[model samples]
Target: MSLRSSYYLPPQQLRAENLDSPLGLHTRNPQLSWKLRWNERGAAQATVRVVAAASCSALLNRDYLWDSGELRTDATEITYAGATLTSRQRVYWQVQVLDESNRITQWSEVTFFEMGLLTLEDWNSQATWLGNHGITVPLYRLSFHLDQVREDICTARLYSTGIGYYEPRLNGNKLGTQALAPEYTDYDKRIVYNTFDIEKQLCSGENVLGIILAGGYATRYQYGTPVFRAQLEILYHNGQQQLVDTASGPWLVSPGPWRDCDIFNGEWYDARLEQRGWDAPGFIAHEGIWQEVKPSNPCSSTDAPKGELVGTYAQTVEPPK
Candidate 1:
């Protein structure tokens, strides 16, 4: 169930790799990287059939745009050769494979990825650095009112990123089971942001959006600083909208736990410095110390933000990492 924590990947399916419904996604072919377990009885991937479509439901029904019929290859990185992908174009795909023993496995679950702003104009929104550009760890928070919570709230995407690592919370609940935000990549070359669907995570009135970042590669082992940016867009069924973005919003960046957190030295947390409920709405400390965020590129020569992230996540099962 590594692909999806909720469901078991059917037998015969390769352990999916590089197919994590990626974000800040880019690539002409959008390669498919995956692997399978060996049964020790000569079990190996002999052939694979890939199906691609614009939607998930359409994929299972055989209503697809492209089909890679039983190609014999053990190559993990299978590039999408079906259609040209445009900016913000979302594609869903799944594959089934043939084993050496002529055993055909059930189709795997659908995996998807969306293209980022393909052109400069597509990036209508500006970038923002989450907090002070010199601190080691920074935790930002924003509280807003929903006015009216409707079940029709369909599209809710919190596109977020931070130098090193980040953990976003809505109403105190973590965005996903996955610990790491955006996948690991070379920060100098590219920065990955995560898109979360938070429709059910919202309430009728007051809500909180808190994000924390720690030095991952951003600091290069504490040799640099941490940075952050995020954009939230929500679409209501009645055509109404709400947005909470770091570029221009009520987000307040302030100091947080972790006296020192680095990739190599690890994090040092003093229980006495902890501020309970700091991430929840209506709770603010060191008020004057907080400051507004600004726009800055994580992959550019611009200075990075500072602060100790909450936790390392996988390595430490704590929040705000």
Candidate 2:
């Protein structure tokens, strides 16, 4: 039997809720109503389109429309039904609004999102990461190696970090100490030299050269805090002794070269020998062989011995007898 369908109105009307809407809350307010429409935008499914509107009885006129596309007002919305956005995809979107007079409002803010494909060049202009370590200044030590059979000279270079001082050593010998003084004419400056001849001390082949950098300042200490220090060692053989150390004193008193005084000065030799004292005499052996020997004659003429002149020397051979 054909029956006529009848529709009955419920006590409350069904209302759709839009979580993204910025309008004030009004429970069951007839004067204000908003409808929402959405569509997937973009070929890669990376964008989304959202539309909102207010209406009475007829189809609600969309007052605002947002599209995830070119981020411009005229840009078309993207659509992706079954595809998912890839990691390398970049997305952009914008919003459009309409007023009560049905006049279309200007597009709202554009939003953009990108994924993956990050480059270091984008961050190169930024500061260095935390926990970076490096040298703050330059320093050095000069010494020689005696254990080496080939005889080699060793040198050490050091740097300061705006605090403390350092001492350098080569082989087992201590080159010198780099100390910082407040009242001194120069402070915290590096010293350099052209070349150090440790051949007198250095021996051939495998030699262990070392540098002891003391970072603690005696004057700056308050109580029991030990100063910071670093030690570096290198193994090298016979090679050219190249001076790479430089001076960087802060005092403006003198223009003279400081390194030359410390390294080139003949004091290093005297200091080494004097420090060793009696022990040095044992290490060095003297050969009795004389280069020239002549009889001592007090009565002989001072002009010339016999017939020999200053620049003339006679070689004699014994007869076969």
List ranges where model 2 is wrong by over 4 Å: 1-163, 176-197, 217-321
lDDT string, candidate 2, 181-276, tens digits: 111111223211111123444435433332222223322342111122222222236554332211211101111111212212221122322222
Per-candidate local distance difference test: 0.63, 0.24
Task: Please give each candidate's TM-score.
Answer: 0.69, 0.19
In model 1, the runs with Cα more than 4 Å from the true position are 1-17, 20-24, 33-47, 60-62, 70-77, 96-126, 133-136, 147-150, 177-186, 215-225, 238-241, 284-321
Q: Evaluate residue 166 in candidate 2 and report its C-alpha lDDT on the 0 to 100 scale.
A: 31
lDDT of 1 at 273: 59
- Please report the TM-score between candidate 1 and the true structure: 0.69
Residue-by-residue lDDT tens digits, candidate 1, 217-283: 6667443566666666778878887665446556667667778876667888767756667677667
